[model samples]
Target: MSSTAAGSPEPPSPRTVTPAVETVLAFVNTRADGTGRRELFEDGDSFADWLAEFGGFGGFGGFDGETVATDADAAAARELRDALVTVLLAHSGDEESLGEPLRHAERHLRRAGSLYPLATVVTAGGVELASPQTGVERVFGTVLAAVTTFAGSGDWGRVKACRNPPCHFGFLDRTRNGGGLYCSPGCGSQVSMRNYRRRLRQES
Candidate 1:
């Protein structure tokens, strides 16, 4: 609920229920801002709270109902999120600046992607490959699966991080041309004003 002036349009609600994209966004938006900033994954409990509230795992086929996240899991989640932000930013065309972080993220993502084991399942419609995972594996597996599916289909580009500082929130770009640059119109205006002031200073 970050604001921009008294009557400006509010930032769009963070996307948190779109299959694998949901998992990516939940981690990305963990750093809360606006009234005050707080790290949503300060610990295992907080991370678990976020998962229950917005992890969006319910639609990722099936998973173990008993698995719970740990401190290590929280740390891992943050690491993955940091790398994802870099990769997503690079996708937005800043690969030069985000190169190192992108590499670092690649390593983590590659490792996490291996946790889920693929199996051939005979569904009523036909046969297809499915990922079967449990516990921590299920948690990370669902994310990796979603990324793989989306990236292959060209929808991954629509997932992006906002450019506004202190608010690098992740959002799904639903625009016609896929040119969204901010998480909200308010953020767009904020950056616009900042650019305008810079121009004024240069002119003066």
Candidate 2:
């Protein structure tokens, strides 16, 4: 079994999620931060391991595990992942918690869109947008396509990153009113306690 980063928050239990949302969350959660940080794409071999596990989501395929990811490809993937995490933080209403400006994230995503443009694919069953590129570029395109699909269906807002600092895990908010702030109750309590202590310090 793959080892987790020391102090890394436990992976949340699996929940029912569409293929698109699943793809987005899987990609974004690769960077798990805690007392220590764990990056799944730290090297070419690690990147391949991650691809072997999640590259083939339903309706989004063509990523070959054998494809060697260069350092440039890994860097590009990290850029896209970080930008997506920023967007998900906005969806959770915690944009201010992180210093990353949403507009900057928007610009990065726009640049990525140009770098990995999607092609229109029409089939008898339905219309789809897919990437014509191969290898690592195709992986990037697949992730973009998933984001586009979920955003169009209005489900994009339901995906969010945890509000707690250093534990910004991505999760699907399944609450009835969609008011989920943190990934788990433990994280919520951590934030609440931190706030309470701050208030006490102010009064003291």
Candidate 3:
């Protein structure tokens, strides 16, 4: 529904049906690249702003909007976000795009898991993962819980970052075959054209 930098309308992409998927995408997209680059958790105030915007989402019930974020918390949030982007890049078969090795990213995620462990919650409706911590740590736990839940459903592979450089936007691949590579047709076209030019030069 959004237009690209060139004023072209982006093709309709599949919307995530699960709240878990929505949460993961929202968290990963906070630091999207290219012309739409955004760093939502640059500082304590900015991190607080991000919490105000997405803290009320389904899995984020433990977030305390009133709780203030420290600079340390903001830095941790950025580290977590980058690690997540690395994993999502792997999902899109572009693990090296972010320049962080996948193994390093995995280790960071493991460290994060220990820092913000998720708790199991049972209700009359069903069972779910919830964060016991409050404030920003809770936000991290909830994001991890979302990823775990969606990954358990076998749909985690569908959650991917765009393969196009400088436009590694997070998106849910809803194509029939789950072969989506780019976030939009424009990104795909850009990659194709670049590849074509490279091929021509090589042939020359």
- The predicted structure with the larger lDDT, 1 or 2, is 2
lDDT scores in order = 0.66, 0.78, 0.79
Ranking by TM-score: 3, 2, 1
Worst-scoring 10-residue span by lDDT in model 3: 1-10
lDDT, candidate 3, 1-204, per-residue tens: 111234445523444456777788888788747486778888888888778776677556544567588888889988998888888888888957445578888899999999999887775545678789877788888889888877766677898888898878888898888899899999999999999999999999
- Name the runs in model 3 displaced over 4 angstroms: 1-16, 61-67, 95-100
Instruction: Candidate 1: give the clashing pairs.
Output: none
Best by TM-score: 3
In model 2, what lDDT does residue 132 have? 84
TM-score (C-alpha, index-matched) for candidate 1: 0.75
Cα TM-score per model = 0.75, 0.85, 0.85
Over 4 Å off, model 2: 1-16, 35-37, 58-60, 63-65, 97-100
Q: Between which residue pairs do clashes occur in model 2? A: none
lDDT of 2 by residue, 72-148 (tens): 77888888998888888888888583564888888999998998898877654456778788878888888898888
The CA lDDT at 193 in model 3 is 100
Report the Cα lDDT for candidate 1. 0.66
